[model samples]
Target: MGEFELIRRYFAPMAKATKPALDGSGLLLGVGDDCAIQRVPANQDLVFSVDTLVEGVHFPLGYCPRFLGWRALAVAVSDLAAMGAQPVCFTLALTLPAADEAWLEGFAAGLAEAGQQFGIVLAGGDTTRGPLTLSLQVHGTVPQGQALRRDGAREGDLVCVSGQLGDAGAALEFLYDTAPATDAASLLQRYHCPQPRLELGIALRSMASAAIDISDGLHADLLHILRASGVGATIDLAALPLSPALRRIKGGAAAGFALQSGDDYELCVTVPEQRWAAASRELQQQLTVIGQVQQEPGLRLNADAGMVYSQRPGFDHFSIT
Candidate 1:
């Protein structure tokens, strides 16, 4: 099948299905265009971010196409979530080894489901012949002055993360059979179907002092906020959130994963003490306070006697072997 034909068969319908429902909203033009046009509402600033995922590096050798479709878009939109942006639309660039019809069908179905979930539409994209890789550029918008930024953290701000951590890390073990358990559905879901903290990020608008989505491991991504704001933090080890599945199935690695596992897609935010109560009420117990921002310039973990300095690198795509 030809490229345009492939798009028509699988992707064009996604755009067409949602076009009329929009009734001339944020996305003006979608699909079959050299460029997609969108309208930004007054007092809102446009936000854009692109993410690329290659087979093997980003996923297993033969991950489910449908889940891959959802995950690819979820990870990209997580950037918008981090910035307190409401997802608008996205463009995709897919490279495949072949025009596998079955793969395309499942992948498109998954993509469509995620699009609906995130309230985003597919604008336009390209398909090329090569090693399988999915690149998506997501567009969003945030209120002019309320966009969350990483450089606004202040001393005494509380560091918080949404949802329990370590589930994804435990799930990774099962993917390769490195861990002994085999009946971990929730952990596997954590790995395959990461839920981006979109609502929480949007709610964080003026409440959070600074924020970032935890794409890398919790420690690694939180370090980004600290560095950007020129601040430091002290995280209590006991306060790290661990899901029941992770604690029960992969107990030994629970702490490690919570501290260093990647792909959680949860939000790590810093909010001032005065705002903590308001933020707490807003989240409605969906978040946990794990640490506190400080004037010092390093990350510390609480220990029995004192704080332990840590500089461990998170998942690095280009780590030296």
Candidate 2:
């Protein structure tokens, strides 16, 4: 099929599938337009983020198309969540070696499912022939002056993460055949389909002093907050949350995975000590306090043996071998 025909059949329906149900909507125009028109609600600011996923680098060569569709958009939406913004709409730019009908069908279904789940409409984008790659730009909104920022953390604030970590990293071992068999399904699900913590972010808008989505692993992502906020942190190795599947791995590998494994997509946030009670109550069982911000200017890990330093904290595109 032609490019326009492909879009009409596979992508156009996604635009309508996720149209906001609320009144006074911001999406004035979506797909099929040269440019999307959006209106920022009164007393709110628009938050924007873009993410790109390359075929071999981001996922396996023969990865599932549907999961790729969902993950591509979900990764970008996680950025909005870190800012404590509600997702509004998104644009997609897809590059493909060829337009295979079966692949497009699965991809469209997954993309639409994510849009419907997140209440985000497809805005406008482009498609071209090339190696398989997906780039998504997402738009969200937060009440003026209430958007959580990485630079807002302060000394004495408690650092917390939403949900468990290291599952996705452990899952990667199975995918790459680097580890013995365990529970592959649960781990793969965490790696393939990441659930952005949008609701939790919204709840913490008034409570969190600083926030960041842990796309690049806890150590690296937390350092971002520290640098941006001009502070340091002391994280307890024992406090890192690990999934049952991850913990089952032999030789106590879960700790290393939790600290350095990327693609967990959980939010790492800092809450003021005074607001910890309210924040923890709002988050309920989803929040885990793993550390505290400090007046010093470096990341310190409190381990059972003693204090430890991290040499490599996360994935670096250029540095990856």
Error of 2 at 67 (Å): 0.8
What TM-score does candidate 1 reach?
0.93
TM-score of every prediction relative to native: 0.93, 0.94
lDDT of 1: 0.86
Model 2: residues >4 Å from true position, as ranges?
A: 18-23, 176-182, 280-284, 306-310
On residues 146-264, what C-alpha lDDT tens digit does candidate 1 reach at each position?
89999999999999999988777668767755444544777888888888889888888878989888888889999999999999999987788888877776555456557887888
The runs of at least 3 residues in candidate 1 whose Cα sits more than 4 Å from the true structure, single-residue gaps closed, are: 19-24, 176-183, 280-284, 304-311
Model 2 misses residue 255 by how many Å?
1.4
Give a tens-digit lDDT track for model 2, residues 1-321. 789998988888877754444666678888886788888888899999999999889988988889988888888999999999999999999999999999998888888888888878898889999999899999999999999999999999999999998888778767755454557778888888999999999998998999999998898999999999999999988888887777776236566658988898899999898888754555757889999999999988877754233568578899866
